[model samples]
Target: MTEIELNGSSAGLSGLTAVPWKNGSLNEALACYFCPQKTLQADRPKLGKVFTARNLSRIAGIEIRWTTNLADHLRLVDDDQVVFIFHCASFLQLQKSLDKSPFPDSFLQETLDTLALLFPSSDNETTNWLKSLTKIDPRLARCGSLRTRERRLENFNYWHDQLVILKQAFDESSPRNISQWWFDRRNGVQWYTFWIAILVFVVTIFFGIVQSIEGALQVYLSYKSIQSG
Candidate 1:
C-alpha cells in the first residue's frame, strides 16, 4: 500500500491506495487457452482389446483442452486493435502450428469460441467487420480432420504391438510348451516327470487290454451255458 499525503477530512481510505491486484493466470484474452472450462467428471475407460473403437483417442496425442501455449506475439496485440489483429493472426499461427503440433480438433474449435466470446460484436458495423476479417482459414479448418486420421494410425499401431506381445505369451503358454516351461533351468525343483508320465501312459494301455479280455471271457461263458440248457 502507498499512502499519499491527502489533506484530512476525506472519508475514503485516508489517501492510501493499494497495489494493483494480480492473479496466477495469464491475460484474460488468453485465459481460455491457459484454463479450460471444467469438464464433466467421469471414469476414463482404459483400452480394452488390441483393436477398439476408442483406441485412437487413447493412443493419439488428442488434446481435450489446449495443453500448450500460443506464440508470445499474439499476446502482444494492442487492446484497441485486439479483434482486428488477433482474428487474422491467430488463424495463421494455428495453421502453421498444426503442421508440427498434435493439437486435436476440439482444441481449435474451443479456441475460436473463446475468442468470439472475448470480442463480441457491439453494432452492425463491427459485426460486418468481423465476418470479412475472421473468414475461416482453410488450413485451420482442416486440422480436425487431419488429426482424426493421425489418431487412427497411432491407435492401430498400438494394437499391432499389443497383438504381437499377446501372440508371444500365448505361444509360450501353449500345451506343447507346458512341460518344457515347468522343467526349465530356472525352476528350483530340478526334477522332471517326463519319464514318469510315459510309464503311466504304458500302464493305462495294459489296464485297457486286461479289461477287454475279461469282458470277452464272460460273454463266451454265458453263451455256452445258454446253449447247453
Candidate 2:
C-alpha cells in the first residue's frame, strides 16, 4: 500500500491502491494527468444553460455513462472514457438537477463528504479528482478559474474551502485519536449552539452568585432591624 505524509503523519492511499490499475502505473498516470500543464479546451460556446448528463457529455466530448455504484464513478479509467456519477444511490438520485446558478454550499459540502469517504487518506488525490471533475465540463472549468468573477468565484472558493475543511476533518478523525471527533463533526449551527450553551451557563452562574450576595445582604439587614427594634 502506498503512503503519503499528511500533517506529519503517514496516511495510506487506500482509494488509489484499491483501483484496478497496478500501483506503479496508477501513480504514473495520476502524475501525468494531474500535472500543472493546462488542459486543452474544446472549441465550444460558454456553457450557460442548465446541464444534463447527456448534454454535458456532448459538450465535453466525453461519454459520461451513468453508474449505479459510486465506486465505479470515482475510479478513472481514462480521460476520454469516464463514468459521471453523483452521490445519490436511489432511483430519485437521477432526478436531481443542476443549473447555471452557483451551487449551494450544502451541495458542495455533500459532494466533498462523498469524495472523502473514498479518498480519506489523501487530500491531494481527493482535490485532484475534484479538479479533474471540474475540468471535464466547460461550464465548471470556466467558472472554477481564478479569473472568473461574481458568484462563480464564490462557488469555487466554497468548494476549495470545503476541501480544506474535509482535510482537517480527516486529520482529526484519525484512528490514532478519536477525542477530536466533535471538532470535525461541528457545523456552523453546532458551533453556534455550543457557544450559546456556554454563554447561558455563565449567565446562570453569574445570576446565582448575585442572588446569594443579595440574600445575604437582606438577611444581615433584617437581623440588624430586629436587634434595633
Candidate 3:
C-alpha cells in the first residue's frame, strides 16, 4: 500500500507505502508498469496511446533528463515508437484509480475558481471551461471526502488525467488562456514604477547636494572678501 501525494492532493493506494518521488519520478512510473496478467485484472484497455514514461513525464511536468538510482531512464528506438515498460504496481494502482475518479477535475475546478478570483484577467477561459465541465458532468463538480487509499488513488488519478487533458486542449485551443496575462501586466507596471521612483529620488538627492555645495562656496567667498577688506 504505497501512498503518494502531490501538491497537496493525495492518492491513496492500498498495500503500498509512500515511495516518494525523488529524481526520476517519470522513470519510476515507467518501471512500475504492470504485466498483462495484472493489467488485465485491472481491466485496462490495451489500445490507443498507452501511457509511457515519456508521456507520464509530460503529464507530470518533469524533464526526461531526470533520473535516480531507484529508477532507470527509458531508451526508445524512435520518438513515435511506443514502448510499454514496467511501472510499480502501486503506480498503476494509483494511476488507474485516478483515471476512474472525479477528484482530479474537482481539484482543477476549485483551483481555477480561486485563481479567477485572485487573478481575474488570466484565468477567464480556464475558469469558464472548468465551470462548463462541472455543468456537463456535475459529478466532476464536487470534491471527494477522505476515503480509503484505493478509492483516493482512483479518484486522484482520474481527476489528474482529466486536468492534463484539459490543460493540453487549453494549450491548443484558440488564444490559449493562461495565468501569464495577469502576471505580464502587473510585472511590467511594478518594474516601471520601481525605476521611476528610483529616478525621482536620485534627482532630488542630486539637487540637494548641488545646493549644499553652492552654499559652502558662497560662504567661503564671503569670508575671503571680509579678510581682504
Worst 10 residues of 2 by lDDT: 141-150
lDDT value for model 3:
0.33
Off-target runs (Cα >4 Å) in candidate 3 are 1-186
Model 1 spans with C-alpha error above 4 angstroms: 1-70, 73-85, 89-101, 121-123, 131-229
lDDT of 2 by residue, 1-229 (tens): 1233334443333333222333455445334332232222223212222122232233233345434332234333354345334333222222234443132334444444333333332334334544556323222212121211211212322233322332232223221222222232324575567668878999999999999999999999999999999
Each candidate structure's TM-score, on Cα atoms with residue i matched to residue i, is 0.20, 0.26, 0.26
In model 2, where do residues sit more than 4 Å from their true spots?
1-186
Q: Highest lDDT: which candidate?
A: 2
> Which digits, one per residue and each the tens of the lDDT, describe model 1 over residues 1-229?
1112223332233222212224433223233333333322213212222221111112221111211223221221222121111233255445446754333444445444323322333334334433554344322222222122222212232122322332233223322343433423222343245555767989999999999999999999999999999
Alpha carbon lDDT at 107, candidate 3: 35
Model 2 residue 54 CA deviation (Å) reads 41
- Give residue 142's error in model 2 in angstroms: 23
lDDT of each: 0.33, 0.37, 0.33
